[model samples]
Target chain A: MDLVNALVVFANFVLIPATAYGAQLALGALGVTLIYGILRFSNFAHGDTMAFGTMVTILCTWGLQALGVSFGPLPTALLALPIGIAATAALVLGTDRIVYRFYRRQKAQPTILVIVSLGVMFVMNGIVRLIIGVNDQNFSDGERFVITAREFKAATGLAEGLAIKTTQAVTVVAAIVVVAALFWFLQRTRTGKSMRAFSDNEDLALLSGINPDRVVQITWILAAALAAIAGVLYGLDKSFKPFTYFQLLLPIFAAAIVGGLGSPLGAIAGGFIIAFSEVFVTYAWKKVLGYALPDAWAPDTLVQLLSTDYKFAVSFTILIVVLLFMPTGLFRGKS
Target chain B: MNMRNLMLFAGVAILFVLTGILQSWNLSLSILNMALLSAIMALGVNIQWGYAGLFNTGVMGFTALGGLAVVLVAAQPVPEAWRAGGPGVLLALLVGAGVLAAAIALHKRMPRGRMRTITLLVVLTGGFFLFRALFDPNAEAIEAVNPATSGYMGGLGLPSLWAWPVGGVLAAAAAWGIGKTALGLRSDYLAIATLGIAEIIISVLKNEDWLARGVKNVISLPRPWPVPYEVDLQQDPRFLQVAAEWGFDPVTGSSILVKLLYGGLFVAVLLALIWLSERALNAPWGRMMRAIRDNEVAASAMGKDVTGRHLQVFVIGSAVIGIAGAMMTSMDTQLIPGTYNPLRFTFLVWVMVIVGGSGNNWGAVLGGLLVGWLWLIVESLGPIVMSGVTASMADGPLKAHLVDSAQHMRLLTLGIVLLLVLRFSPRGLIPEK
Candidate 1:
């Protein structure tokens, strides 16, 4: 019973929240990795792109709420996700046409493209701020929690209660479904095969009559969709703030690079690795330790490795270690 | 200078003159001072990116370190706080550094095996607990020493100008550590690493209350020598008589005099940097750096230590940025960690560098002045521009929102400017010859 109580406490704080955060990071990493794979440039604008998509989803969610639309037991954001994806796709496609296409034609260096994306990031950031002022916007409306702590305690008859947030559950489910569909599309579809070919060898793919433009377009659309879903889910789990999304760039980039920049499987693994490290290092293990250990052995301190404010440092340390040891990352997608 | 460059500088001068004529002399002088600092920041970036092709997104971190230096070197010491926990805090820091050094030495000396891993873990865990035990209590005590005002151990109370070079050294040390790790990696990896380091530095500044009072801020720092306070100048009879002879109010004259002094100091620093930069660019070392940047493979084949050069340039550039940051903080007479946002400190400087011309020091200075002017002007003009655009529109939330959000237009306008320059004039206004 004591062990079970410890498990409950661990799950409540470390496991569940990390899993939800990991899923959001995985989706975000997948988008970043895909862009790195196909575009051959690190998109500095990716975080702002996520903010733009989330802003659109939030606006649409507000509009739907006004129209008396509701998704019972789930966020109205889920219903608004498709519109967000579509709008994001349109925006990205337009951006590519206007800004990135010229660079592609020039065959500019990747570093140059990165700087160009910084310009795009600025514009997108400004637009988002203009549309939705820089403040926390709470959009999760339908249900707050899947299992309340009090209900969990009553059911389990334990001192420690395990509460699962509705957004967390939805995030994990949505992430799994999205990942599965993405893998299926990439593995089984013809267009996806063409994209793979292009990413593998651009000249060879062109020689074999794979349309470069189409592959680039489809990549942008898929990436935009992924970013939109990830952004909306993240906003639902936490509060939506433009600056926070910008800050998320570090962790997202860490995950993508740690997973191997162009590898999807690596991105998912890297996301979980970063998310778990951040959560575990910051979590105070005192409650769980108190439950698991005998009274005499139990510690009095918080037992946290680092303060929660140092969360970025956790990801950064992990990123540096990975870079030092494995420059090509775990899955060895590309250097 | 060439005709085009001369014309560009002339144009920037005209803008400043126009600001003074149209607005107030105080505003123009303040903008000029800021522009001078921005130019220094841009020059630092140009050294790295233009000379070495290293992408350092951690400019904010270096700048903040400079601000921290000003506090640590110039602010009055909090004797009470030091009495409470100063020695303990120093001992803890030394222990922490010793532990890290020991771990690194162990990693190097010990063979890779399970036993080694176990030993390393034991040492680290024990060290961490030891560190926490020493750190937490001492930090708490330090913070408890009159929490309202002087809760943290303060500086040496040196002249504030000393903080400028100290800031440079502080930033250089940090850059050395970062560059040592990230310089040899993939180009984008360096960018990401720098970006992460910057965020971490900021978080440290925001949370570490025992250092610079964190978010509570450190205000009323002493001014550097040779720049008199406006209040003092106003009280001086000689200054009042001079003001009267010049047909100006003493208050206005005093303020203008103070700004002019600041502007003179800034100009001296900017000119020195440009001269040094020009001399270096003309040297053989500059040629080698450019050669390395243009083709690292060829340069490495020629036996150049590419990574070492990159690290060197990175350190040098960061030191310059640190100096500029310290200067800005001193000018502001306060150190607010919260205000060091990346948009203003990091990317905007990048815009200045890129728009000025990457390989040219003069271009950077011009870019800094022009963009700095535009950034401030946009803020002032945003509402006016929006109101003018919405004058024909009906009174509604949409109009109100647009007018209210006009300040954000600077970002959009900056983006447009960057994109336009990259597209049409990728070399920028003062392209490298």
Candidate 2:
């Protein structure tokens, strides 16, 4: 019983939250990795892109709410997600045409592209702020929890109880479906193979008659979809704020680089690793320890590896270590 | 000067004069002061990206380090707080460093295997706990010591002037650590690494209440130059007489004089930096840096230590930025770590550098002045433009939204300006020779 209780506590604090967070980060990292793999430049504006998409989703969610639309026991954001993704896809494609195409034609270095992305980041950030002022917007409306702690406690008759949020369940389910579909698309499709080929060797792919423009467009569309879904999920789990999304860039980039920037599998693995580390390190383990240890031997203080405020530091430390030891990342990326 | 460069300077001068005539001398001088500082920041970026091709996206972090220098060098020490935990905190940090050094030595001596990894982890885990054991209590005690005013362990109580070079040194030290790890990587990797470190630095600044009081903020840092209070100046008959002779009101005269003092100090520093920058750019060292930047593999093939040169330039560039940051802290008379947002402090400086011309010092200066002027002007004029567009609209949410949206056009303008410059004059208004 004690063991079960302890496990439940651990699940409540560390396992469940980390899994939800990991799914969100994994989705975000996938978008970043896809772009880096194909475009051959780190999109610093990726976070702002996420923010812009999430903003669109939030606005649409509100519009739907006003129109008396609702998703039973789930966030109405799910219903609005497709429209958000489409809008974001158009925006990204337009940006590529207007700004990035010029640099691509010039045969500019990747660093120049990265700087141009910074410009795009600013523009996107400005647009997001203009549309939705820089404040926390809580738009997640519906059933709050899939399994309330009270319900769990009543069922289990344990000292500790686990609560699963509706958003958390939706995030996991949605992520699995999206990731599975993405994998299927990448593995089973000719266009996907061409994208992989183009990423592998651009010159060879070009000579082999791969439509570079189509691959680029497809990559942007997929990235925008992933970014939009990830952003909306994250905002539902937490709250929508433009600046927080911008701050998410570090962890997202960290996950991509840690996973191997150009490798899809590596990004997913890296995201989970980062999410788990951040959650586990910052979690105060006194309650679980108290349940596990003999009464006198139980720790008095919260045995946290670091404070929660140092969450970014956790990802950063991991990123630095990964970069130092394995520049190509966990999987062999472009070294 | 070249004709293009001369014209750019003339344009900046005219903008400042217009600001003075249209607005007030105080506002004009204020903008000039910030522009001068922005120019310094731009110059620092020019050294890295312009010379050595290092994408340092951590300008805000280095600037924050400079702010930390101001707090450390100038703020009055809290004796009671120090007494509570100062030695213990110092010893814990030393022990933390020692533990890491020992772990590194152990890892190096041992074979690369599981045993080494286990030993290293053991040492690190033990050290972390031991370090925490010493650190937490002292931190709590220190924080508890007069929590309202000076709960944190304070600084050296030295004059503000000492902070400028100290800030440079501190930021240089941080840059050295970052560059040592990151400079060998690709440009994008360096950008990511720098950005991560910067965010980590900011998180530390925000969370570590013991250091610079964190979000509580340390205000009214001592200034070196004379800052005449307008009321005090007005009370002085000799000051009134001087103001009368100068055909200036006492209030405006005092404010203008104070700004002029800052302007004079800022110019002195800017001129010194420019002189040094020009000398270095003309030197063979500068040529090697440019060569390394243009083609790293070729430079390496020529037996140049590419990473070493990159590190050197990175350090120098960060040091210059740190100096500017320290100067900015002094100008504001406070150190608010919360205000050091990467968007405002880091990316804006990059815009200045890129728009000015990456490789040219004069271009950087011009870009800084021009961009800074535009930043302020757009911010002031955005509402008017928005209102004009909304003139046909009814008084409602849409109109209100448009007005608010105008306020955000500064960022939009910044992006458009940057993209346009990159497209039209990729080399900048004053192309590098």
- lDDT by residue for model 1 over B380-401, one digit each (tens)? 7779989999999999999999
Span of ten consecutive residues with least summed lDDT in model 2 chain B: B224-233
Off by over 4 Å in 2: B226-232, B388-392
Reported per model, the fraction of native interface contacts reproduced equals 0.77, 0.73
True lDDT of residue A261, candidate 1: 95
Best by lDDT: 1
Residue A195 accuracy (lDDT) in model 2: 93
Residue B177's C-alpha lDDT in candidate 1? 88
**Residue-level error in angstroms, candidate 1, position A333:** 2.2
- Candidate 1: Cα lDDT at B351: 96
For candidate 1, the iRMS in Å is: 0.6
User: Which candidate's DockQ is highest?
Assistant: 1
- Tens digit per residue, CA lDDT, model 2, B294-353: 888899999999989999999999999999999999888798878998988899999999
**CAPRI class of candidate 1:** high
Regions of candidate 1 where Cα sits further than 4 Å from its true position: none
User: A200-271, model 1: which lDDT tens digit per residue?
Assistant: 889999999998999999999999999999999999999899999999999999999899999999999999
- The docking quality of candidate 2, as DockQ, is 0.80
